[model samples]
Target: MQLHDFYLSGNCYKVRLFLGLIAQPAELVNVDLPRGAQKRPEFLALNPRGQVPVLVDDGQPLVDSQAILVYLARRYADTHWHPQDAFSQGQIAGWLSLTANEIHNGVARARVGLKFGRPVDLEDAQARGRQVLELVNAHLANRSWLVGEQPTIADVAVYPYLAMAEEGGLELAPYPHLNSWIARIRALPGYVDLPRF
Candidate 1:
């Protein structure tokens, strides 16, 4: 597999975390987002959206981080990453969707705004980020993992930027349960630190 992505991207980091945990090594092709490498005609031919995290396997490109996660999980029979039970499966899927739509769009984008030159709506973004954090905290309060008593692709899918919410000006103080969960994930064998976090 060849993963073409911006190295600093959380979306790309999700795939890296999964590959690391699954012990599946792949060729990492760094895409220079700031340099508009993803927008180039050659790269655009692979994914018109010109997004980071375009995974090419057997000459077939898989765009979208969530889709790549499902593909890797299924292809490797990654049982721990994606379980077999229907209910648990739904739970994972729900979280994956939230990671893509809510977490990535809301918290991550807000952080990028503040990090880059863009003006950040601090109040609005922080409030929404806190809301998302609270929801995650609630789900994790009594559980060690997101689904099926183990860390799944769902957990790996959302863990990167979230572990560094403070970067977005979202404090970690209120989400003790989530903080603890972050520690648990970090202590895992194949855990890799995100550069910003």
Candidate 2:
């Protein structure tokens, strides 16, 4: 399998982290996002959206980080990472939504926008990102992991951006529970530092 991704993108890092956790090795083909290498004709043929973390397996391409995580869980591990119960699966889905909507939008977008010299609505993004963090911190107050007591793909899916929220100026100091949880996740085996996208 070949995973085409930008080294520093949080979205891309999510997939890489999952693969590492499962010990699934794949060739990484770096797609230069800032240089617009993803917009090239050859790359566009793989994904119409021109995004990173495009997984190519058996000549088929899978776009989007969340989708690729699901695919990896389904294809690689038929275990607790995805879970068996309907409600548990739903919970995982819920976390995935938060990762994509709140985490990805409020945190990832603002961080990337500001770093790239783009116009980022700092006030709006920061407020919304804080709201998301508050929600996550509250939910995590009584639990060890997001979807289940065990660390699932949902946890892996969301950790990087939230941990590095400070990079975008989103502080984690206020949420002690979140800080503790982030520490736990970081301590897990097979953990890798998120590469700058």
The TM-scores of all predictions, comma-separated, are 0.95, 0.96
lDDT of 2 by residue, 70-162 (tens): 999989964888997899989999999888888877877678767666788887888888998898899899999997778988998889888
Predicted candidate 1 versus true structure: per-residue lDDT over 1-197, tens digit per residue: 89997777888988888888778888999998888999999999999998989999999999999999999998974587888889888988999989977787668867887776467676677777888899999988999888878888888887887886888888888898899999998888877778562
TM-score of 1: 0.95
For model 1, the stretches where C-alpha displacement exceeds 4 angstroms are: none
Q: Candidate 2, after superposition: displacement of residue 134 in Å?
A: 0.6
lDDT per model vs. reference? 0.85, 0.87
Q: Which candidate is the best by TM-score?
A: 2
Please name the candidate that would achieve the greatest lDDT relative to the true structure: 2
